[model samples]
Target chain A: MKYRGKVVVTLKSGVFDPQGVTIKNALHSLSFESVEEVKTGKFFEVLFDAENDAEAEKLLEAMCHQLLANPIIEDFDFSLEKVK
Target chain B: MKYRGKVVVTLKSGVFDPQGVTIKNALHSLSFESVEEVKTGKFFEVLFDAENDAEAEKLLEAMCHQLLANPIIEDFDFSLEKVK
Candidate 1:
């Protein structure tokens, strides 16, 4: 079976997010007075072949660990759906 | 009311995505022979106060248009869940 997945890779807590902070500042400048915070991350849409759900999950995990995310500064999570 | 929202910003189709291509090549290098494609985008987690769902959606839309994404090269979509 083929599977489609989305992976969200985010900075772990306490990591400095200059982009997020800049975005927050921009929101404030836009006069959104109640804006609290903004955190930014990466999102990926991947399509690949797998035999079953377990196979897909394992491949996704390896992909996340090896390439999609930087383990030192980022943490990753994902969801998969069978596509045909 | 306060609401939390997630925004996804993606490069429009046909826009050159060097980053995505580079990542795909890396996956191929890892022996993921069946890898088809990889598309990369941005994810944002935002917290802010709004009077209601309509208000929150409106604010989120404006944020995406004005700041979170570039209208020229990217398209953005979002979802909101009321938080407290």
Candidate 2:
């Protein structure tokens, strides 16, 4: 079977987000004073083949752990769906 | 009222994604050969105050247009929810 996955990787809480901070500053300068905070993360769409749902889930988890996220500072979650 | 927004920004179709290509190659090198393709994007969480739903939606749209995405090469979508 073929599957498509959507993964979101975010920095762990307590980690400083410089990019988010910069964005907030930019918004403030643009007169968006009501904006309070911003947090930024990464999104990935992966297409691949797998034998079944269980195998696909295992592979997805391994992929996220090994390459998609930094265990020390980031966390990742993903969803997978069968594709034609 | 306060709202929380989640925004996803992705490259428009036909745009070359060097990062995604790199990730796919890396996965292959790591023996995940079933991987066929990959695409990368940005995710953002924004917290802010707005008078109502309409005001929040308008602000979010402007934020995307003005800073969150590159109009020529990327497209953005978002969801907003009220928060205490």
Q: List the residue pairs that clash in candidate 1.
A: none
Task: Give candidate 2 misplaced runs (Cα > 4 Å).
Answer: none
Off by over 4 Å in 1: none
What is the C-alpha lDDT profile of model 1 across A5-74, one tens digit per residue?
8999999999999999999998999987788989999999898999889999999999999999999999
lDDT of all predictions, in order shown?
A: 0.92, 0.96
What lDDT tens digits, residue by residue, belong to model 2 across residues B1-84? 999999989999999999999999999998999999999999999999999999999999999999999999999989999998
Predicted model with the maximum DockQ = 2
Per candidate, chain B TM-score? Answer: 0.97, 0.95
Best by TM-score: 2
TM-score of each: 0.95, 0.96
lDDT of 1 by residue, B3-47 (tens): 999998999999998888888899999998778889999999999
